[model samples]
Target: MRPPIDSGTVLITGACSRIGRELARQLARRARTLVLVAHQKEPLEELRDELLASNPTLGVAVEKCDLSHPDEVDALLDSLHRHLIQVDVLVNNAEQGEFGLYEQQRWPHIHQMLRANVSAPMLLTHRLLRRMVERGRGGILNIGSGGGRLYIPGMAVYAGTRHFLEGFTESLRLELVGTGVVVTRVEPGPVAVDAHAPPSWMSISAVRCAREALEGFERASPLVYPGLAYRWMMRLVSLMPRPLMRATGMMAAKKLRQGTALLEERGQRVLLAGGPEALSR
Candidate 1:
């Protein structure tokens, strides 16, 4: 069954950024109301203004919230409650990740990643799911990543969290099968959000990704791979044996380790030549 996108209020986290912004822009013409949640107020307001300019009748609310903090998420929900805005659709789109060796990552940064990528979505779902169930109509669109399916050495923690979402979304879909609350996960490959081209075979523009994701969610598809080329590639990869997948991943892991070694060597030379202060600089 298709989600009631054209009928109810949709709550979108990370509503100020690339995919989130595009989703809000597109959904403005569809959803009766849009609740835009982000870490900063200014960008969210800017987006809201832009949306209002195009669709003057659309109801838009901007909520500044850092999803990594539980208190902030709670406050955000409270604020929504006070406004008498019940969410009919939930888009768990906010995510943060550090691209480096797991050991080199700071504890605080790692914790924040976990909170944003995993804890925040889980908590939001828990708080809002009951209302959706009671209302007998709702939608959950999880913006996941291809990293959830593959083994990546450098992005250990980030990949792990995506895997959690992959599993969680799939199981949740099964549980809510008969219920009107439709759930779908969109696992996109690299998305080219900037002028600089990403070095990948499976990359699509953020606008296209958002459009495809929404289409899939509305159709109540279990999983969506955004790009056409990337979808085919992932379909092929899924058929590969586990050992073969691991072996292919090992190649990437080796290259990352080699790059780390070269960086260490350069750091050592700088330390010896110009002292600790120079190295820091």
Candidate 2:
């Protein structure tokens, strides 16, 4: 069984993209109100319309702002505050990943990735944690990647940021132990959202992933892995020696790169539903 969110407002970052979009859609029907955050203006608006079209009674507000820019996030939050918005659930779902050696990765891109994946969520939590603490009830789900626990060669920075969240969420959960405020870290495997280049792994649909994630959210678990396959894979990987895990990551990355090259040569970019840049970048 899970707790109901009849009167709580939910805020979802990157709400126009694959997983985020699906999460917003799933929660809109049950959640009292929703604040959707995304970087692009037009797409965010489009998502807002789509949601409203389906659920006219749903209270949905779209904020077009780049989470990579702390200033913009602050502005958006400030606007929400001025309007007396009360958030009861937060989904830190915005993140960008770059695959390559740390030395070869561009610095600017790394900084943006860090800001989006780590700093932005941390900042948002810092600002909103007080409210949830004061109200003595709410939930915060930090969406992370399996790379947080499993080492992958081409994703050092990505892995580090996700691992940091693993530690951060655990510590926060302890602090909010008796406060009725729950914190959970949701680690989903290679979602079909951005699994264009792959070794033919079965990627779970974004809607399915969101559904499973929210099921865990309602349970208020401290940590959740969405799919059974991901759970089994993690268990098996955890049993493997560290050296073996590293070798497997290298092999996987190599295979992905080979596929990417093949697709690029054909002048056809494999991407998520919305657009190519949305997935490839």
lDDT of each: 0.86, 0.79
Which one is best on lDDT? 1
Residue range 96-205, candidate 1, lDDT tens digits: 86666678777888898899999999999999999998988999999988888988777888789999999999999999988899999999887765523452566777
Deviation in Å, model 1, residue 194 alpha carbon? 4.1
TM-score of each: 0.92, 0.85
Instruction: Please identify model 2 stretches exceeding 4 Å from their true place.
Output: 1-4, 194-201, 247-281
Q: What is the lDDT for 235 in model 1?
A: 94
lDDT of 2 by residue, 118-163 (tens): 8999999999889888888888889987778887655777888888
Q: What shift in Å separates residue 99 of candidate 2 from its native position after superposition?
A: 1.6
Give the RMSD in angstroms, all C-alphas superposed, for model 2.
Answer: 4.7
Maximum-TM-score candidate: 1
